[model samples]
Every structure is written in C-alpha cells, then in structure tokens.
Target chain A: MMTTETVNVQDEKKSAFLGSISSAFQGAETYATLRKSAWDTLSKFAIPGTKTEAWKYTRVGKVINHSWMKSHGNSQINLPEIAIGGLRYVFVDGLFRADLSDELTYPGLNIRRTGENAENNLLGTLSNHQGDWFEALNAAFFNDGLVIEVDKNAQIDRPVHLVFFTSEENTASFSRNVLSLQESSSLHVFTHYIGSEHSTFSSVVTEAFVGKNAALKIDKIQEGNETAFHHVDWTKQDRDSRFDITTVTLKSSWVRNDLNIRVAGENCHSSLTGAYLPSGKEHVDNHTMVDHMVPNCESDEKYKGIVRENATAVFNGKVFVRPDAQKTNAFQQNANIVLDDTATMFSKPELEIYADDVKCSHGSTTGQFDEEAVFYLRARGIGEVMARKLLVEAFLADVITTLSDERLQTYCTEKIQQLMHS
Target chain B: MLHIKDLHANIDGTEILKGLSLDIKPGEIHAIMGPNGSGKSTLASVLAGNEDYEITGGSVTFGDKDLLDLSTEDRAREGLFLAFQYPVEIPGVSNINFLRTAVNEIRQYKGEEPMSAGDFLKLVKERSALVELDGKLANRSVNEGFSGGEKKRNEVFQMAMLEPKLAILDETDSGLDIDALKIVAQGVNAMRSPERSFVVITHYQRLLDYIVPDFVHVLYKGKIVKSGSKELALELEARGYDWIKEEVSA
Candidate 1:
C-alpha cells in the first residue's frame, strides 16, 4: 500500500508537468517536432533525488516537484536603474516589455522577439537534453525570449542590459535567450533576474555562439524574495571566443545555475566567477562546467559563498579536458564562510581529465571569518559590525571585482556592500 | 596613564596571570623581560581585550576609564594599542584603505570630521616612510605576502599611525635581524613623547640597547618578582633568566 501511494504521487506529478508543457506549445508549429522530441528525451530521465551522484549534495526532488510550474504573466513593472549608458531590454514576469525597453539604433546589432514568425530553431539546436531536469524542462516549455545578433568586426561601445523582473506570485516562468556573434565581434551583457517578495519560479536558458576571435562577457545577477523558488540558468560558449561569465545571487531560497563554457576552437580563454550569500535557511546551488575540447585553451573559475544563519550552499564545479585538448591550463577555486555552527556548506570541485599534458589545480575551503583578522581590524578602532562587514567584503572582492567593466564592477561592489549590511 | 591592580586572569579554566600589577606614567618606557610560560603575551592580550582570557579578579583603569568595561575597539579608541607579536595576514584588504578606515573611525569617535582624501594619502605617505615600508607594500593587502621583518615593521608603523597613549609591544624583537631591529627601534623612539608611554615586553635585552627603557621589570610565573633600573636588564641579559628564577625561589 505504501509503495502504491509513493508511485501514485510521482505519477501525478509527471502527468501534471507533461500536460502543462504540451499545451503551452501545442499550436507552435515552428518548434513542434523539436518540442516533442525534447519532451520525450526529458521524460526518460527522472528528476534527481538524493541518491544521484551529482544530486547527492543538493536534493532537487522537492524543488522540481513543487506545484507552481505552469502560469506566466506580462504585467508591466518599474525597473531599477543599474547602469548609466547601455542598451536596455526589460522583461516582466518572463515576458518582454517593449515600452520599458530602449529602441535599438546602434550599429552592427539586431534584436528580435521570438515567436512563430521567427525563422530559426536555435533554441533546440543550442540546448541539448542533458540529464539535467531543469534544462530539459526549460527546453520543453520555454515560449519566448530575445534573439540577438552582432555583426562581424563591430564592437559595441556600451553594454547590453537585460532586466527580468517577476511581479506575480506562485507562478512559474521560463525564457530562452539566444545570441550569436560574428568573427572578431565583441559584446557585453549585464543581466538581472529580480522578483517580488513572493513565491515565484523563474528559469532562464541563454545560448550564446561566439565566433572566431570574438569576445563576450555576461554578468548575471539574481535578486529575488526569500520565499521565491525555482531558478535555473544555463549558458554555452563556442569556438575561439573569449568568454567570461559572472553570476551573483543576492536573495533566493532555491537556485540552480548551470554555467557551461565550451572551448571549441584552439587558444580560447574562458573564466567564470560567482559570488553568493545564502541567508536565513536559503539554499543556492551552483554547478559550473568548462569543457576544454580543443588544444591550447585555458580556463579559470572562482566562486565565493557566504552561508549565514542556518542557510546552506552547494558548489559543484567541474572541468573537463578532452583527449585532444592538450596544453590546457585550468584552475578553479571555491571559498565559503559559514557564519555560525548552524550554517552549512557543501563544496565538490571535480576535474575530469583525458589529456596527458595539462597544468590544472583546483581547491576549496569552507570556514568562518578569520577571528584574528576581525580582531586585527577591531583593534584598530573599527567597530565590531563594521569590521565584520569589511572582512566579508574583502572575502568577496576577488570574485566581485572580476567584472571587466569598471562601472559594472562598481555596481557589484555597491551591491555587495548593501548585501553585507543587510 | 594606565594602571592594573591585582589582575587575575585565566584561559580555559587554567590560571595564566595571577595577581599581576603594573602602573604606567606619562613619558615612561618600561621593559618587562620574562622567560617562557611567564604570562607576558597573556598580559598583552588581556590588556588588548582579547576574549580568550577571562579576568576572574582584576581592576584595570586606562586614562581614567574602566578598561575592563569596554570592548576591544573601544579600548583602541580610548588610546590603547597593542603591537602583536604575530601580525595576522588579512588578504584583499588594502593596508591603506584599512588604515584610513581605522583613522577615520578613531577620529569619528573623538567628534572630529573625516579626513580629506588628499590629507589621508599624504599622512599615509609620511607614516609608511617612518618604518621604511615600501610604497607598493603599503598599498597591497594588509600584512598579506609580507615577510617576517615586514610584518614586524607594519606593527610598528601601525603604532606610529594610531599614536596610542600607552602602547604594548609583545615580543616585537623576536624574529628581527640586527638592521630590522634597529629600524623598528628607531620608529618606536621617534614616537616617544612626554604624553606617551610604552610597555615593551620581550625576552632579550638587546632591544633595550636602542629604545633605552627607563625601568626594567621581571615577570615570572604570571607575576612580577623583581623590579629595578635599566641596568637590571643588562644584568639579566648578561646572567640569563635562570639566575632570576633562583633569586625568586630564594
């Protein structure tokens, strides 16, 4: 009888999820075949449980099985000002807001909203059904997002900002963004995912193709309410492009970021830096993977986490060096600080190597703030609270200051200072 | 300027400093020489408000304020400084930035306006030179990647910057070479004034040759057992601490 009840619960969840996905894209002839195939592939793999190797540290069954995974809205909202000079694209509740966005007139750039009128199926081609249920779910259900293209040899003076804000409660939303760059092109994206202080589910899947010798940098930040759940982020880089991805999570109970960089061509350089603070029983999981597929490539990853007041954080960083990827130099480090004994952190930095010649080193450490350092500051007349804040900022400076743009770096610095105080 | 009477402190329920007493007057430089396990560092830590040590029974008054009632930072703002024997390495915190914050905080506590950027930078340039600290080193992380001599010099530099009324130097000459010791002593000597006092704690009398303490005290087994003039340090140095132990036992 118990076995029957457990099976019944899971079957009910599966049917409900599949039903929502099929109806959402039922009339979409553009991606009808792709959507069906993706759903079929995703149904083959069950949602990860505690027994799964990659999911052992982060049990996502509860997060994925939750009931709020269907509805989305297009309510207009006020967006917070972050940058001074930039091309802005605003989205409310996962739907683009044209009135709030800027009219594009810059050279060598083009952007269009995705719908049935769109010509390409890059979403299906760029995203594969990795055993990850989140990505697979995103592929099966994502309805609309923006497709950006940069011309060859053209450099955008200012950054391109994508602001996503959640206004409804107990609703799930997904956005699939695709960006392509031509040879020697360069672009910068300052992305934000913000939500109200309610239980909102949001998933954003970004697929980027960087051509030969092109460079791209994406600074993604998540600021949601403490009660919100259901967040998944994915990005893929290609060819000899220089790619740098920085993700900072300020508030959210459940978030999963799958940041993958593919060194497809030789002599490519990629870097990923993440800074997160999980407070008050919040949980933030980051799974970063960099695949060195070609020879003469280098990658560096740094992640910093602060687990405060019974909160928890999980960092699982993986680096893959293919057999042909010789002369690869990959380095990864994850440092965390748990404020009290109640707080917990799980760090699993993994390296899967098939190459013979590589200089790679990865390390992780989790501890409380250095008492001696705090006291050293205090002994110099810094107040106790100020001292703690200073040390916390100092701990996160490595990752926070890695933003290439000076303005973006200052923005992050000020945000970090506010977070430390809050 | 500072006074400690019947100071009894312990760590982890073990008695470390038992009924220790000391008095400091303005413009006085007193050197306390002691052997191992003699509570010299413990005294320094207790005076600096390190929480690891508990005062079971004691009375500490500094600048007419109850020293035991204030926190570590308040003690600092009240004109008490401790030059740590082992300075901690705080990475990513620029030395210049932290010193500026410390100075501003102290100034704020004293009802003074914040220093301007130009003035602060100028002060930093002048102070970093007192200990012969490298300009680049002073701009990097606090004490990070600093050598032993550099760390020691940083402590002295901080002391010069803070300009405490009563400064406690705990084993400042432990790992210094001859030249570093001379330079560090010069920094200390330069800060001496009629309104400033120092409590120099060390094992050897070699540092006294440069700083020239007016009085010398012997700390043995958590208490002071002997007191005399500056020549007492020379005699103890020439004879060694074993003779002091014998004298105390007798």
Candidate 2:
C-alpha cells in the first residue's frame, strides 16, 4: 500500500518530462522510435541525486528543477570564432551549417548518418548503461549529430574539429556527439563549444568509443558569455586503447564537465588534463572518473586552474580499481592558483581500490603565487602584472606540455594570455 | 653613490640590522665581511627594498633619491641589482625569456624601447659566455634543475644582462668549486667600471682573491664596527671573525 503512493508520484513526474522530450523530437524523422523507447526508459528512472556514489560531489538535482526541457526553435544566430584554426564544423541551434564545413575526403574515414535502426548500434547500446538521465534526455531530443567512424589500422593525418554553436536565448539546449575509433586507428578530435552572445543553458553529452589498440586525442575548448551555463557528460573507452583528453575553459557563468572512462581491456592507457582560467564571478567545475576494470591499466590525470576576481572552481577526480584489476597504476593531481583573496577552489580526489598490487596516488594543492619567485622577477625590473603572468604561465606549462598538438598548445597559450588581460 | 645612515631593520620582530651605516662611491668595490647572523644579507636586502623587513630607522640615499621609498622593482629599474645568496628556481620559464623580459622591463622603465629579439638573443649569448653558461642552459627554465655552481653563474649572468649601477653580491661565492669561483669572479671583474659600484657580502676571503675590493668593512651585531682597505680582508681571513667579535665586545 505504501509502495503504491511512491510509484504514483514517480509516474506523474516521468510522464510530464517525457512528454516534453517527445515533443522536442517532432520534426526529426530518424530518431522517433528510439526517442520513444528512451523516453519510456527514462520514465522509470528518477533523476540521480548527490547520494549516488558517482554523483556524490556533483549535485544534479539542482539542475533538474530548472526549465531544462524548454525547446529552442530555429533562430537567427552568429557564432564567434573559437580561437582554433582548422577545418571547422559550425552547428547553429543544433542544425549543421554547410558553408562552414568542407567537402574534402580522406582515406579510411567515413562521416554519415547511421541507418534508421542504428538505435541498437554499438554506441547506442553503451549509452544505455544505468539508463543515465542525461544520456536518455540527449537521445530523446537530439536533433542532428554526426556519426564519425575510423577504419581499422588507418591513421588520420589531420585532426578532425567539431564545433558546437548555439544562439537560442533563455532556453536550454540538448545535443549529442558520437565518435568511434577502430582497432589500431589513430585520430585527433577537437570539440569547441561556443555560445551566442546570449544567456542560456547548454546541455551536451558526448559518447566516444575507442577500440582495442586504438589511439584518440581529444581537445575540448569551452568559451561562452559569463551568463551561460554548460553541462557535458562523456563515456566511451576500451582495452589497450589510449585516450588523451584535455579541456581549456575560459568563461562561463556555470560550467560542469563530466568525463568517465572504463578500461575494459588490459594494457589500456589514459592521460586526462584540464586547465581553466576563470575570472569575473565565473564558475567552472570538472569531474573525471577512470575505472580500471581490467588488469594492467594505467591513467594519469592533471588539472590546473587560475582563478581571479571572485570566481569559483571545483575539481572532483576519482580512480576506481576493481578487485581483479591488479597491476593498475593511476596518478592524479590538481593544482590551482588563486590570484585574488576572494577566488576559491574546491578539489576532491578519491581512490577506491579493491585490488592489491596497485599503485595509485592523488593530491591537490591551492595557493597564491610564490613570494620569492615574484620578488625574484621584480628584482629583475619586471612589473607586477608581467611577473604574475609569467608565474601563471609557468604553473600551467606542465599541463599544457601534456598536449602534443602544437597548434592547440599555442592556441591555449594565447587564450590564457587573453584571459589574464580580460 | 650610496649612503646608509643608522639603518635599522626588523623581520618578524627580530632586529637583524641595528644602526648599520656605510658609504660607497662609484669606481670602488666594497666587501662587507661578518660572522654568521651578522646582518650582512639583511643589509643587502634592505638596500634592494625587500618588503619583508620593516625599516624601523634608517636613511639610504642612492644617487640623490631615497632608496627606501622606492619599491623593489623600482629600485631595480633605477639600476640596482642583487645577486641572491640562494637564487629561486622558476620552473617552465626559459632563462632566455626571463632575461629578455628583465632587460626590456628595465629599458622601458628608463624610457627606452624594448630591445629587438635578435639583439636580445645576442646580448644573452654574450652575457652567458661571460659566466661560462651554456646556451642550452639559457634556453631551459630559469635556474630549474641547475647545479649549485650553475645557479650562482646564472645570477652573474643576470647581473650582466641588467648591468645595474649598483650590484650587490650576496654570498655569491658560496657552494662553488674553485673553477666556478674563478669564472664568476672574472665575470664580475669584467663588468667592473668607474661608473659602476658593487657591495660584495661574503664570510670567506677566497672570493676577494679574484675580485679585489677597494674598501673592506667588518659588520658586527648589525653595525659596521670596522672599516679598512682591502688588506683587512686577508687579516680577517687569517685570524677569523672571533678576534673581530672580541674587539667589538671590548
């Protein structure tokens, strides 16, 4: 008798949320059935709260109460350059722009829409894990997303850049990104998120699947107006696969990026690094999880942030080692530089290990610039501003060095400089 | 060129330099010898305008300007240099870039334009050779992973790049082999000119052998208790600071 009351309350909330999601996909012909099925699954699962182990530090309940289901129709918009120079893809209001994309072709690369029944495909199957609320939401309302596939043993010479642009104001955006890498294949992926000069909340979920012996390098840049809010969730990695991901966040009213990697095969490796330069009451949160489900897996995570003004930042990193996953090596470090006294950084690093013979270490540190170093620079006649900039550059150099792409590295450097000026 | 009148400074409620006074003119190198905790380093720091020390009482006049009123960087831009006793290592900033910034900052402060990249590189090469510093070391982070002697040498290289009017060497001779000592001293001696002055703070007379001083002052208990010619350094080295301490007590 008590269960009936709880079930009834849950059922009523689900139908309303589901109806909104279904209506958002009215014009899209390809994903109608998949959206219906995802909607049904989501109706059974409640939005996760902080009590969930994976969502402990991140409070998703606060985000659910907001009007996130509001749909943004086609609107006139202009996208700002992402400070990245390359072949770019521009998506305005979830519609791809042909003028911004190139028709050039490369060997061993295929970009096209999957079949109508691609709902049961490899990536779609993985997205059903735990029936994640955000994943379901993206699936139910995703208008158009590219399906990029790499051929086995093929090496992509140039890095592929994916740019997401939006101009809908006062509305939330739901977007999806799918990337798949074949065995022994190598590719570089750049995902740039740019918002129109408007205030809005943008929700994006990206699933990347790296096959055995495959290598993938990803660079994520998030730059938007300070009034903007963005949420990003990503999953998808395999055994003997190498995934290198780095994110640079410049400005956002509120930004949260969740990156989850499961190393299911032996000898897999992951290098995750993120740098955020937040100023003027901005906030940036980065949460990462690396699961060593198999033996002989390794991961190294380094995140750095330079917070000025009254900005706030959060970094939550967790590395999990299963009981059978012996011989796992994991290292994580988060260091922040607080320029102003009011700037604050919250860092939580956790290691959950059920396996023996594993090497894991995590550490976090937050502090102002070194007085001795500043004095040394000043003693050389360098002004206060330049001295602080030099120290900040030095602080971020190690993480930036973790990036192999020279173009991205230079671009990040210039962006950091500009952020300091701003 | 410089005058200190009854200079008294305190750090963390402890008075290190008490009523110290001295005078130096251009075309002269003055060596200040003292025992441990004798405030030799404090005098150099106070001269360079270190903000940590509170100047309870003192007047330091350099080239007709009140030295204590200026900030550390202002003092530096005004042609004052201090080769730290223990140089700080700033990781990930190339030595070349750091030196170039220092040079250009000083130049700009003097109302001169920044040096061109090529000219700056040329200056770096010339100054580095003066201290036996390898070009690769200049390209590496500032003093990062540098050996003890290499760190001291890097200090001299900076001194050369800035070419300040008043250079204070704070224990620059410490932690150096004989070869490094010679190279460092040669670099300092090469920069010597009638228009420049130096205040070398050291305990041992070994460094004075290479860079001969024109005047020698014995600092005792935060004050200069004895002043003499360069020969006084040999006497102090042979007899040690104990005799000087005894003389001050008497």
Give the Cα-based TM-score of candidate 1 against the true structure: 0.95
Model 1 chain B weakest lDDT span, ten residues long: B120-129
- Poorly placed runs, candidate 2 (over 4 Å): A1-65, A68-74, A82-85, A104-106, A113-120, A128-132, A226-240
lDDT of 2 at B234: 95
| TM-scores of the candidates, chain A only | 0.92, 0.86
All candidates: CA RMSD (Å): 3.0, 3.5
Using all chains and alpha carbons, the TM-scores for the candidates as numbered come to 0.95, 0.91
For candidate 1, lDDT tens digit of each residue in A52-95?
A: 66666776654455565444455646677787588998877777
Global lDDT of model 2: 0.80
- TM-score, chain A only, candidate 2, equals 0.86
Instruction: Give per-residue lDDT, candidate 2, residue A195.
Output: 71
What's the CA error at residue B55 for candidate 1, in Å?
0.9
With a 3 Å backbone cut-off (N, CA, C), the pairs that clash in candidate 2 are: A239-A265
